[model samples]
Target: MTPHNELRLLPWSGPDGKPCFLLSTDGPLSRLAGLTEAAQLDIAADLLEHAHEVLADESSAPEELRLVPSDLTGALGDALRVAASRGHRLPTPGTSDHGDSNEVPHLPAGAFG
Candidate 1:
């Protein structure tokens, strides 16, 4: 178990729809975290089929078209965060090294902003 002062990976997003990596000890993850993980996986799985459908339908609503990509991106982002933290390979097989520190470029702090 990680110490209380140490950072722990929470399986959810923060208030602003970003991954919520927070500090934790031996305490269990929040209910919201579990719900968010399940929801993200569900969205990811459904997007596989639904995205095709939306693309094939010419009459697809603008809202539907707009949301699918946004949601899919969010789902993929969450999955990437979890996988990166766990040092696990991504779902799709690729030549990229999932756990190679040398291969992965290290970004400076506050790079996102």
Candidate 2:
């Protein structure tokens, strides 16, 4: 069982769209969450490729362009959620369990406004 502060953030929402979390990291629920997160990431990747194709086409219709943002918005939300969940799991810098000290985290393009 993980400590309260180390709870795993679930990929799906609970009742009424509330955030869900897992206490145990070694169980059926945890496996399911892992699979779900992987699927979400794969879907987001596919959507991104499609978005790029749509955007790069000079003759794309307004209707086609309009739909890309709506789809991208949802994918972005899932990606951000996944990033936050994984970020929380990373060992803090300067901690005993931290990985290579030379590793530096890079922010995504336009991460800061």
Candidate 3:
């Protein structure tokens, strides 16, 4: 069994659309993991381009305008996950020890729900 404490960044999401992660000791990246990461980055890149285009369009619909923020934010989060998987550890939000006591507020469970 995979060790419970060994960290692994998940490349896909749960059935409810939430991101999922795993725990496994130092092992080679699985074929599925590699493929998933590539696919996710590709999709994110496409979405980013689409989001920029939507923002640039003078005649964008109200719905498209509303989508821009969520789309961009989601892409950024995905990119962060990919970066984390490559061994760049992101500091835990509230654990920053720079004497800044203002904790970053956690977002509500769902996006704009």
Candidate 4:
């Protein structure tokens, strides 16, 4: 179990559309949340690829183009939620647990280009 102040951010929202959280790190609910997060990431990846394809096609209809933004928006939301959840779980810098390795490795400029 984590400390009271260190609740794990859940991947899904509550009935009121507010964020949910996990207090303990074990049990069925935690496992379900992990699975849900993985599924959300997978869906977001697929949606991103599909969005690129749709945008790159010059002949795509206006209706098709319009739909892509809505889908992308949902995917982006899911991705941001996942990131926040995972980020909260990372060991803080200078902690003996993970040491000072919390810094993300720098990518070369234009690595994605």
TM-score of each: 0.48, 0.76, 0.56, 0.79
Q: Against the correct fold, how does model 2 do in TM-score?
A: 0.76
Model 3, position 83: C-alpha lDDT score: 81
Error of 4 at 9 (Å): 0.8
List runs of model 4 lying over 4 Å from the truth: 1-5, 98-113
Give lDDT tens digits, candidate 2, residues 7-112.
8888888889988988786889988887888988999999999999999999999998999999989988888888877777776655434445755577988998
Clashing pairs in 4: none
Number of backbone clashes in candidate 1: 0
Supply the global lDDT for candidate 2.
Answer: 0.82
Off by over 4 Å in 3: 1-6, 13-29, 88-113
Pick the winner on TM-score between candidates 2 and 4.
4
The candidate maximizing lDDT is: 4
Candidates 1 and 4, the one with greater TM-score: 4
Go through the candidates in order and give each one's C-alpha lDDT: 0.65, 0.82, 0.72, 0.85
Rank by TM-score, highest first: 4, 2, 3, 1
List the pairs of residues colliding in candidate 1.
Answer: none
Best by TM-score: 4
Q: Once superposed on the true structure, which residue ranges of model 2 sit more than 4 Å away at CA?
A: 1-5, 94-113
**Worst window of 10 by summed lDDT in candidate 1:** 88-97
Candidate 2: RMSD to truth:
5.8
Instruction: Give the local distance difference test score of model 4.
Output: 0.85
